[model samples]
Target: MQSAGNGSEDEAQHYREGQEPPNPIAGITGDVPGTAVQAGAIYGGVHFHSHANDEGAVCQLPLAPAGFTDREGELGRLAQVHAEVGDTRQVRLVVLTGPGGVGKTALATRFLREAMAEFPDGQLYADLAGFAPEEAVEPDETLDAFLRALGVAPGEIPRGLAARSALFRQRTKGRRIAVLLDNALSAAQVRALLPGEGAHLVVVTSRLRLTGLVAHRPRFLDIGPLDAAAAVRLLNGLVAGHRATIGAGTFRDLARLGGNLPLALCAIAGRLVMRPDRSAERMVAELDDERRRLAVLSRHEERPVRAVFDVSYLSLPEEAARLYRLLGLHPGPDFDVRAAAALAGIDYLDAEEHLEYLVAASLLGERGDGRFAFHDLLRIHARERARDDEPAREREAALERLFDYYLRTAVAADLTLNPGRWHLNPMFEDARESPAVFEGRTSALDWLATELPTLRALVLLARDSGRNQAAWQLCEALWMLFSLRKHYGAWTATHQAGLAAAEDLDDPAAQARMLVALAGAHMNLGEVDTATELYRRAHELWVRAGHRLGQAAALENLGVADIVNQDPRSAIARFTAALRIFEEQGEARGVAIMDRRLGEAHRDAGEYDAAIGYLTRAVDYLTTTGDDYMASRALVGLAACYLQAGPLEVADTTLGQALRVSQRAGARMEVARVHQMLGELAQLRGHPRSSREHLQRALSSYTELGAPEAETVRQHLADLESDTGEEHPGEELS
Candidate 1:
């Protein structure tokens, strides 16, 4: 310590005397310690030294992928992780895992390039070739490269793996660097290259799970295949210079055929680019065949989607591979373990284990809530595997079991949601094996909402495959979802398919049911005239089939159409006749629903007293029955009556109650309607700010639902703004 002080004091004296001090290290030259050093120096001796700090920050990040599209979500997640790991002692490690050709490396590179400012110490990149045909790069090689990038002299670098790792940590201490270890083979490979200390960020992209990085507290992000829109964009970018013209629909078809994988889409785009004279429509027709689709997507043999998928598929354990192949036969968009078990003819525990294994291997993805789904391309590859490897009988049996599972599960959900509703499908009586259980109407509706897409697809599949009964029944089972959730597109499409299936079967009652469902969809879509025609046809069919309940249901739907058409007198007559039929049939719920309809009609007719009486009775009955959704509608009607009459306070209280009931029941339409009424009431009370707030909330809800009422709420907000002379008003009053 004394000798160190004496040397430093002597150097200080030499500096004060206006003379340079001797270099402390031999064969070294620099201005002074704690001062900037000049760039570019050469040293030659047994012992050589250079100013390590003279090197500029290493900017080793590769150019971001060309035509990078729709990774804002992943980039945002990276930003969030960076924000959360602020200034921590431990280095932040983010592992991006997904199947090959899923664009994990592109996402990582894009994020790091955009985030360069965060790492002043600079960027480093290494490609380990984890899933390539060649052997993966070793960790020691990556470490060596990283050490050199960090400005370590060649002679000073350690030879042993442990020493290199320790030196890397020592070199990176207190430096904020960003290291991208691309195509990593394992957690160990990634670990060896990670910065040993400092608030650094290390992002690793790998096709494998790399679960061994758990001790490092790595955040794992799973990159999935591009969506259809992004896939089309990628194709468009790749083929921008080509003379070939493709229609939007043809592009979408190509994207679907390619399973929206970026690699496959690029190949498709390459085909279009190379053959500029070829028609995309013809290309789509050729790619539509599953057997040839993979071949078409293999235009780029270097990174063919099929070959990439084969590598992942071949690496899977035997049981997981078998389950993955059978999952290709699953008719639904996604599946749970129970459905997988049904497809594979295995038990739940085994299915879960296999599915987990596939998920880890990136052959499958967990779709939340204990469900798993394959990437579309992986699904196609799995289908090809099943077609080639599995016997025809086995494939057919797997599909049949999956279809049965979906059918029985849909029926169970239907009966649970609509207890005692008339169902003509014989599948209701068929024994269900391991059907999904719903605790109540809410749970049933939730399940229906989540599975709506799958259900719609299966309905079409069944209809096309000559499973007529299954088709119509699946449509009928979806009635509750369509009625409540108001997915008008799915409702209309599935019912049209169901109607065709019904006609094919020549069943009058089934036809009536499908017509009613289709009419409801049209009614919600503002096609009142079309809805009315459908309802009348349904009523005629119900009469022909001698089904009075169906007849009453049709009458009620027609009354709803009448209300929408603003013909209160016609609505009243329709509701009155339907009410009588419901009463005669002892359908209490039907009667309450009719009462609500009558109340709505009376409110529009300027008969506040009659509306109040009808709506109050309906609300009391529906509330007692735990039908909060219907009760909220009736309450809104009652509130409108009170608002039209003289009791503003009662109207406000009623709307508040309706809002709570609608929210609790998840009746989004009713919730929006209540907000609309509240906005009108606030307007009437000269509370412009309050009116604007309520109307804006209503507008947001309606806009999200794609409901026409959004326009009404927007008009309300506009009028309030005009009346108050406030272009943008202040916060709401108490």
Candidate 2:
């Protein structure tokens, strides 16, 4: 859709003396000097809203624990703390500190649920996993998730902790939000997430008191074991049907044996509920004996929770028990049915059944998203059981299956998104099983985004476990996602590990791919020098390996680096070389892509005619191939050439087409680029108000994406304002 032109009759009269227009096209036929150029009347009707109103209430809190008991006094204390701090502009901070299995998380979850009405905007929750065997969740990772929940697109999210932290604060600044930071390791992690100048409530749970947060004046609530009466009530609720059979006195005995801890009490109750035929007296004796045995073995005071875990785990069916042990080796924070099936080497239905059984036993928690996770103490116990019961070979085999599953599934998703892209990984054939099927591009990208963190962990796990091939292959499979989402942190970390793994395996092709991928991240982040070095290294490797496609890809990357370095001549040369290889290989898509890049290089060098020829050919080929995303990009470049040359009307039309196509393809970044060029075109036509409108749209989109170009656009807007003085009536441009 095009907007109407504001050219007055006088302006049209001035154009009447114009010399012949630069290009020959359908709309223009000019001869006499200063004659009116008969470009068709500016078509106007389409209004595009690139950014939809998707930022609404984001409720990320998981379901509260069932049968929550006691803590009336603690709840009152929380209310009192909120009363003292909630009215302030600063974020209200509360720390629930206690030992593991002492119900700290349960307490926080319960309090937040009850206090939800005060935070109408929504709640955010994250498990820091401070005490888990794996690395603690980093603040940047949590911030990324939080920002996405708050409606920040993945590509729009900034890289690095500071930028992301600042963006998070900006997004949540005035929202009355509630945040629960579970199992936090340190005050630093908590501090990075504090919202800016809001009446937000932030609740943190940790085993340590987190005295480091004392400066924030956090209201520290130290949770302990539930009172005896409360523990009895919890047991009574969980094992209601069996309470009569267990008798009233036995409930107290069981609660005492469980140390009145919620986790232990739940486990004890799970055993009672599962075996309605068994008497509560017999269950208490079994738990007490296990506690004594563990105490002796540990050479410490009695471990009631571990004892309870042991009893519950021992009661599992053989298949369920095996699945539980194998799950301990899972590298991710949580897992779905498919992952569980892979880990246990069982079919999906069987794995689902086993997982449900584990949940019923209180050894696992349902995430309510077709996934499951274990409590910190329960996870530790499961790992211990796997170590003690399963053989080393069996454990390794289960892990291998998991790695294969992820690699194959990720490769499937990648191919779905970019089927024609060259790939070096053999996992597409070597890894067995049907990879996860995605319905389309949107679903494929969604899956990739959802599993990114787990996939990153798996890459490290594969590398550390000596599965070098799988490690590098996983990185290769993730290339599509990194390119689309621009998750720079994961992109850098995984590629580094993948590069190391390739080196260890002495695979030159794999190493080259990893280097090129890593370089792309640096290039996007504006580290052109670093990117150039990496691309050079990769090119050398590709040449040595005699991989023509790899060589071409590397050369193309070098061309991009050259452009970023402001060496258009060198970029042109590099693109020419890459184009030659693409033609030799008969790769039509690659050829078109190189042509697009060449057009950009020429445009930067002010060779507008050559740029237009290259860009038009690219646009034609890409459009014919139904590659709307690349076609939209080429159209933008073509319009930029038109804007620089003559025929501003043609530039406007081309931009309208580009905007429509980019929106159709969901290419937000390209859409922003088109808007930016449109803004410039409007300014050239003396439509100052229209220029500001387009420029503002560009700035907003660029800022959301955390692109460095945002600053340039902001400067452009500042200059426009300076030039125009104040807003005035002007024709709008589409």
Candidate 3:
């Protein structure tokens, strides 16, 4: 008999699709539920009840709602819980917890009232007032109430809380009674009210999960946001006689706008019922404004929309409340543990615990990915609370910290995935406790994919917030985006926002950087002339700023645009001009990059000897600098030049080195390019089968990367099959 806590629900809100799911309590016992669970049939079971009468059962439970329709699942779970009572010596504990207005007390009333025959000794109910605006009902006072209901005369009831509880237990001993502790605050309060060693049942409904009850090994049912279909059914049932007066579309809008919160649904239905002349459309229209939706989602005479939220919010610990408020400030759909840590300015573990506590309080939802989010209405409510309660500077600081954390972490991921991109010097300090850590390039790319939308939104936000330097740097940080990822649209949009921010700051260097990045996006999109104009602007800005490296990089980009235009002569001229400055700067990486550019321009112009000379220099320089990933690319180009010169042996050796280096560096794109070169070389050397295999692997790699070259690789495989008289057209590369 370990004892004590307040209520239960939604520590883990969602689960994996099609997975039967682990014990939902996995996190409380070291299992986490950051990833939310979908709302559906939960903890399946059969419900059975006897039709026998309970002539003398003192049922003080509130009347089940007249409009009550679905809860068949919860009712069945209740019956299952009741059936398990005989298997144990102590009273069976069934605790129901979820968000306020989620209809906990009503569900208990519906279950206990129908299952009266299972508890012949008696059925008792008490509103413990745990989440009441005022102090909750005490355990002692509750025992007094139970004693009197158990036929104890007022004079015979004990004065002491412990004694009265003992008397109540003794009177109900070995009796198959059912006790409903509604609106309970803590397990300790209910612990004193549990029947001792009997086949009796004790059901608890609370706003917080009574985690303290874990010691007693109670069944915890986490009631999620009410199901949408079920909520519609509920609204339809509530206004049954008035259905013709309600619009079907209005009910849908109402259910969605309510976030399927049963309490809100009930309130909406109640409004329709109260105003028989009103249409569901009219009422839903009233509830449509997010800012005032909560206020309007109320019962005719009940406390307004935020009343339940107020009571629940006030009931939480101060730290938990602060976390809840600050978390709402994050402008993302959902956020991971690290972001939560930054939002609260707390340790990651501490932030997680705070999130758990808020979940327990039914304020936040945990998704399966270890991320925490809330229903939109709750989010809006939290934001309103933060604005009303917190100081302006505090809120702004928290937002800036969150912005800084995401920018710094995302930049780190970008560098990990695309190290060859030019890095911008951050003008602001990183506020994150720890930057994001990736296991390898694959994981870094995955993180970037997941955060893409959030980062774009933040760039726009940064620009709007007057954080011009941060906004532009954030855009420039993804400089390798056009080459590595297939996010051309996002590439253009983010840089556009950054360009505007750069103009806002009146910073010429920032403008130059933004222009070059935008030009890269256009160059990738095949708008060579547009790209040239942007790069020209960037080169001019760099010239005006006297930034030699910037000027060289801009010229190099212009050369890349010219290459895409199939004007290798222009590309060679630009690369040559850029090379003069690159060599003067004497950075091996920069010089190697220029060498690769010059080699590629020469290769495209069909000058194999010149390609070999420049490509081999790039290979040697990049290899000495430990830039094996880019070196692999240089080596592949050098191999292609060797292939063009009819030196199969040298080409084969170089291609093998490129393969190993790229594989070791986890540069799949470069590896794919190497395979493409190998396939062509093998085809020329009369290795038809070998050519097919290399082409197939290259196609698979290109397909996985969403690169357009997959189609070319496919055509190559088809051509190899055709010439060899081997038919595997769709079979090999499709």
Each model's lDDT comes to 0.79, 0.78, 0.75
List, residue by residue over 404-493, the lDDT tens digit for candidate 3.
Answer: 788777777766655554555642223223454666676766777777777888888888888887789888766544456657777889
Lowest summed lDDT over 10 consecutive residues: which window, candidate 2?
A: 15-24
True lDDT of residue 355, candidate 3 = 89
- What lDDT does model 1 reach? 0.79
- For model 1, the stretches where C-alpha displacement exceeds 4 angstroms are 1-97, 102-206, 213-266, 269-285, 288-291, 299-304, 331-333, 367-371, 412-422, 425-436, 440-442, 565-570, 601-608, 724-734
Candidate 1, 379-493: lDDT as tens digits: 8889989988889999878878877877777788877755546567766655234454777777878888988888898889888988887788889888767766788788888
| Per-residue error (Å), model 1, residue 131 | 6.2
Candidates in order, TM-scores: namely: 0.71, 0.60, 0.77
Better of 2 and 3 by TM-score: 3
Report how far off residue 216 is in candidate 1 (Å).
Answer: 7.1
- In terms of TM-score, which candidate is strongest? 3
* Residue-level lDDT for 137 in candidate 2: 81
Off by over 4 Å in 2: 1-303, 427-436, 663-666, 679-706, 718-733
